[model samples]
Target: MMVCRVFAIFFGNCLCLLLLLSSLADANQANIDCLKTFKSQVEDPNGYLSTWDFGNQTAQGFICKFAGVTCWHDDENRVFSIKISGFGLRGVFPQGFKLCSDLTGLDLSRNNFSGPLPSNISFLQLQHNQFTGTLPPQLAQLRRLKTFSVADNRLEGPIPKFNSAIITSESFANNLNLCGKPLDNCKMTSTNSHSKVVILAALGGFTVTAFVVGIVLGFFCSTISVEQLLFRKSRQNR
Candidate 1:
């Protein structure tokens, strides 16, 4: 009876440990999926991402072999950051980056990535890319952002307002059409204000002209009536 009890307790402990390990494995697989999705989105011309292979069990530790990938820990296998500078990649900002919930920092400078920057990415360094379009206001949601930069890109339109102090002139240097605080104060959009002013000025000028014409007509009629009365008196005297 004692032996049976000991065996039962040992079996239960083993089962519990197995369950814990299984959950962690599942989490690691999800991280792998996130990376796979991101890799599919980008166009790596120089084969910089060539080592990203998921075929062999030995390659399961993708964070170690993949270029610019950093994991949370050696055993965890969860991505922490990606700093792929000068990869010569071409594509829109990777929207799939949000899949890596554990991600903290990203640096993708000196690439040909076009389109808008992803709002989901906060702590980013995207300098010297071919990115175009307006800055997304959703970037303000990154409350934990510490360092941000996007200098020397082909981005246009107004830079989104951020409540963080990470943004500065250096972050927005060489971006021709990008304007806002810390840059050029964005050439205050005065189209609507100018239109309203023009309309009011035109109305005032019309009112003044009407008043002057009315006064001139009134004076002319009064003089003609006075002359007519004088003429009638002269005829009666004759």
Candidate 2:
């Protein structure tokens, strides 16, 4: 009876451990699918992202071999970080980044990607890219963001407000049109209508002032003429 009880306990523990491993594997496979989808969207001019291969499921450790992809654990194989930089990859920022729910660090710098940054990421390094567009205001909601950088991009408009302690001017350098708290204040880009309004306002003020001044001067001269004429008439009557 004692031997039977010990065997049952050991078997139960093994079963529980297997269940846990199976769950982790499923989650990691979902993450791999996300990466595979992301790889499909980008244009790899230099064939840098061609290293992402998901063709053979029977092959072991295929997902782990992807360029710039880092897995959480050897046994679990969950995506933890991505570091793909300086490859001249060009495209709109990948939407599949959101699918990596457990992504901690990301570095896609020195590429030719042109678009807005992803909203959900925490740690990001997107420096030296040709990205154009305003910084998304939703980025402030990423409370987990600690390491952030978007330097040397073609981005414009006011820099989105972020935690000053985490982001700074160095992160925004060389972005010609970007401005805000961490950087210089954005010089309001004057539109044609705005310029016209300012000019019209100045002209209107000048015209009103000149009209009032002319009226006052004319009234003063007329009063002086009347006084002079009255004095002449009185002297002639005398």
Candidate 3:
């Protein structure tokens, strides 16, 4: 009976180990699918992503060998970040990145990607791109974001109120219409117009007051000169 109990315990441990391996395999397969889908979505004009050959599925960390891909481990398929800056990649923000559940950092700067970005992004570096549209308000929710930049883009409207201290005017520079904290406040057109009107009114009032005072002084001086002339003529007649 004791021998049977030992055999049962050994079989249970093997089953548990197999289950864990299977889970890992599934996660790795998901990551592979994420990359494959991402590559299919973008336009790689420079052939930079050509090394991403999906032919070899048996090799461990094969995806990590692809250009611009960073893995959490040398021997694992878990992606940590993807830095594909200046690749001349053109496309709307790739939705395939959502499949990469482990992705933390993404740098697509200096590319020609246009259109709005995904609102649920946790990390981003998208400077010097052709991206347009207002920054999403959901970006303020990224409290864990360590680095963020969207400078030199054609984005417009009020920037999200990010709480990170690292964000400054430089982070949002050259974006023609972007405004908010770390940049000029939004809706300043009306304030500026009102200020101009007030200044013009003050100048007009000052000019009118000065002209009235000059006229009063001139009239008083003219009257005194006339009296003096009349007095001199009277003396000459005497």
Identify the leading candidate in terms of TM-score. 1
Instruction: Return the TM-score for candidate 1, rounded to 2 decimals.
Output: 0.77
Q: For model 1, give the RMSD to the true fold.
A: 4.8
lDDT tens digits by residue: candidate 3, 177-213: 9988889888767788999999999999999999999
Kindly indicate the candidate among 1 and 2 with the higher TM-score.
Answer: 1
Model 1: which ten-residue window has the lowest total lDDT? Answer: 56-65
CA deviation > 4 Å runs, candidate 1: 1-23, 57-60, 197-201, 208-238
lDDT of all the models against the reference? 0.83, 0.83, 0.92
What stretches of model 3 exceed 4 Å from their correct place? 188-238
Assess candidate 3 and give its TM-score to the true structure: 0.75
Supply the global lDDT for candidate 2.
0.83
TM-score of each: 0.77, 0.72, 0.75
Error of 3 at 158 (Å): 1.3
Cα lDDT for residue 25, candidate 2: 72
